[model samples]
Target: MVLSMPSPYKHPSTGVYWLKQRVPARLLAVAKGKSVTVTVDGMPCTVKLGDYIKVSLRTKTIAEAKQRANEAEAEFNRIWLSFENGPVKLTLKQITALAGEMYHAISAALEDDPGEAALWAQRRRERAEVGAKLKVSPAAALMIRPPSLEARLGSWVDGALKQHHLTVTPETYQRLLVEFDRAVGDVATLLERRSRGDYSPDAVAQRFPPVEIEQRVAAPKAAKAVGGDDPTTLTGLLAHKQRTQSKKDDTFDKYRGCLKNFIAFVGHEEVGRITKDDVRRWRDALIKRGLAKKTINDQYLTSLKVALNHGVKEFDLPTNVAANIRDERDAPAPTGSKGYSAEQAKTILQATFRGSSKNLEIPYQRALFWVPWICAYTGLRVTEVTQFRGRHLREENGIPYLLITPDDGSTKGKNAWTTGIHAHLIELGLLDMFRAIGDGPAFYTPYPEGTDLKSLSNHRAKSAGDKIADWVTDELGIAAPGDRPSHAWRHAFTTLSRTYKMDKEARDYMLGSRSQTDAREGYGDWSPEVVDAEINKLPRFDVEASDWRPSLELVPPRPLKSDLPPRRPLRVRKLRAKSA
Candidate 1:
């Protein structure tokens, strides 16, 4: 016997035919239901009725079902066409008459078939039972779509705050939003799993619990003046301080580490409850860990004090318990020396050319070659040099310069400044390196977008600096009484600037250091040309490292109009003279 092809209206799961049709966009909202399912000889079949009607002839025999289904479909189309052409609109009286007719027709149908009414009531009970199991009330189930987790949490928080008549600071408000979003996300994940039958309600509650809001009792005016049960912990205070303050990445990391250590030691206690003894004990513990007294004072003590002081001011606490605690006065200075000498700088640069101690990867080798040279010429901090991008390099009035700004990342004082690129660096192919790196960061390998952690970038750059330092110390056997190999270049730059009699304002501007005088010397409209002139005054290094040059040959891209700011004339101030 030959096999027959299946009909297009059949549903594979039920082995029964269905009549499917699309609902018109205009009638979808008012349509009673999309489709209805019926059983044909114990097999479920679907009849789809949109604004227009469609019917399926449900039968086991294929030949009989196809013939009957075509006849039913033709009859439905005829009735739908007649209804469509009959009337587009009706008067208010006519609408009332139609509503009466519908009500009477429904009542007659229920009165005529007691079994149909009973079956309908039974389904209603079953649906109510299922809704109860899902924790959805009958009224809630009537909603078109349930409110999202974020919306629900936001409304709850707003209601809680209003009920308590509480006002929170911007920092506190932001923290609450972050916490609520996290909680909502957790609850939402569990709800999704529960809906998909992957989790039971009890399992969901056990794994991801609901958020609880703490109750606040109404307090007297005097009690309110002193922060009453504010629930702000030491950790919260420290986080708020870091968010509000402008600090470099390295400095911020140190603060975070110090605060974390204090929290671990002292426990996450209330900020107002921490006493001076607690701070002193923490300091003593650091000292017992073999940390130098100076380290305890400078790193641990300073960070703790700042956090407590911030808490005192922000939370209106009675006192800063860590304020009166003093650092060890007789603590010895650090063992190793700081800053490099001229001779040491020469030896380091030469060793970089020779690849003296050990080999490095290409990216690291490139950083090793240029970072020291840039520091040697400009006295920039290692981070400052490493964070450079192609856009930071520009030409103003025919002179090339590096715009040491926080546009890309943090700066020393969180202030923007510009300095000229030394001529020797240009001769050593600095421009070529910028061209090779293109539009993003200039040094080290480019991280994939968001993965560029500031602390990690600084650490890697510092590691590269250390590698150069190690090469100078081990291979060249160069040592100074109080010198750091990479930082020695900065000292060397300062020395050369002073030796050549470069202007104090220009030198300070290049170094990004503050001037001694009360008057803001370089803040007013100083032209890049003047800064470039002072930077050019520094004498070039006369080294014999012939193979130390960068081999990059790409042409530098032209600077955009936004990169090169318009030049303004320097503001000159008149001096007052006194006569005796």
Candidate 2:
């Protein structure tokens, strides 16, 4: 059998094949040569409106080029037909693709022309309207739709059942079904809107709030009434809070501890029976225990007040007994003017490079050596530095940056930002360590694998920070009485940046501390080059010791397998008798 091949002429200069076709009459004047550009041309309105599509063949081989050209031509013809048919009615799939293309085009244009901002906003509004009309979710309208409601719900149910070995009664099962039905109803509503040409998922969601299924159990015959002496205890309020509010395990645990302590002090009386005098006594007792004023207010009193306030609002208690009790204690004095001094920073860096006196493991040593430098340069919180993964190192416009994000774990205030890596850090071989780790976390080893608990990572990172702090304070003797070694570097960065007179916005951008008060900051127009320049302005720490720099020759630890004696040589039984 004979195979047909595409005939393409090779370009003289580039030695690349070129597929030539006749130019359409409408685009003849615009065409530079005899061959037409393989793009939309017959649709004058599309071309005039700058909405025509152009796809690069992206192949040097004639066969591939020709195949791509044919595909492009088919797509162009489809678009041309749509134009000829008057106002085009697009499919959900086509609309999704167009929305993505439009978004990219608008984004590219916005870089060169700030005036495109208004146009981008207008396009977004139009897309949202169209999405609503099409009954698509906001995510679907944006072209990255999630799984179907039924599929997602089924997977979630199966996973929950398998993982927890959950066994539900008929009432509980019905409640679960009700919740699932609400989710299905949301998706159905969006689909219905698409049929009716109401595409704004946000508008639909706003108009119809999500349904919450309440699971109620019949009260026992001997159960106490609201008017009873033990109406709603602190324990009951805590339980109610857990049911209604979403919180991290660590946060809930802290709240529980504080409430438990308060309950112990005041006795587990009904919330209404608790008085301001009781709250005062608890506060005085905490003060007597030598707790810091801030700790007393934040960890103890604040927690108790929150539960009491919830009781007041939810259960119709007489009043929030702890509401009026305020911590009037004076704020603590500054620890050596907030940040570490230059000499102290150098000493800390040297000690970290020297490793812990307690003979810590290599991973812990690396954490001590690198985390402070990162915090010093980036002004990131200690926990943020601890959560650094190899993949977080990203580049834009030839400038490398650390992508500090909450996706790995909790960030302070849940703010996500990027910090330009200083040249000095690279000189100290931080990138080498990053490359060595390669997609795993950089500092803390034994990262919480296959877990969604942010608290685990946070705790591990905090522990690493504490190790560094211990080295600085106990071994180096650099930190002041009130100064924490891990946090001091952040303050040190601020000091250095201020001394160098860096741009305030750039400083804030690097530190992930930008004020949301300015509406214009939402545009996020700060370029990587500008931020990099600001980061470069901060002075590097001066270390006299040559060994202070972290060693670049680092690699991830390999898993240890138990050594077994070589398998005993297997004795082969003679098969000659069988063969004979």
In candidate 1, position 22 carries an lDDT of: 42
- The TM-score obtained by model 2 is 0.53
Model 2 regions lying over 4 Å from their true place: 1-231, 246-249, 332-335, 453-458, 516-519, 545-580
Per-candidate TM-score against the hidden true structure: 0.50, 0.53
Report the lDDT tens digits of candidate 2 across residue range 1-580.
Answer: 0012245556677766544333334433433221112331222111221222333355567777665544444333333322222222223333233223323333334333234334435544554564464465554333332344334444443332222223333223323333443433443434444444444533323222222111111121332544332237665676567667776556667886787666545434457667686688678767766778988998888888888887778777778878878779888675356787777777777665676767775667788889878887888888888877788888887788888887667776666788888998888888878887677765555433454426452355566777877677667656443456677777878888889998888888777787879977767566678878889998877865454644434444432122335667644432211000
The regions of model 1 sitting more than 4 angstroms off are 1-232, 244-250, 265-273, 285-295, 328-337, 356-359, 448-484, 516-519, 548-580
**lDDT (0 to 1) per candidate:** 0.55, 0.57
- Per-residue error at 459 for model 1, in Å? 7.5
Candidate 1's error at 570, in angstroms?
Answer: 64
Using alpha carbons, what is the TM-score of model 1? 0.50
Lowest-lDDT window of 10 residues in candidate 1?
211-220
Which candidate should be chosen as best, given TM-score against the real structure? 2
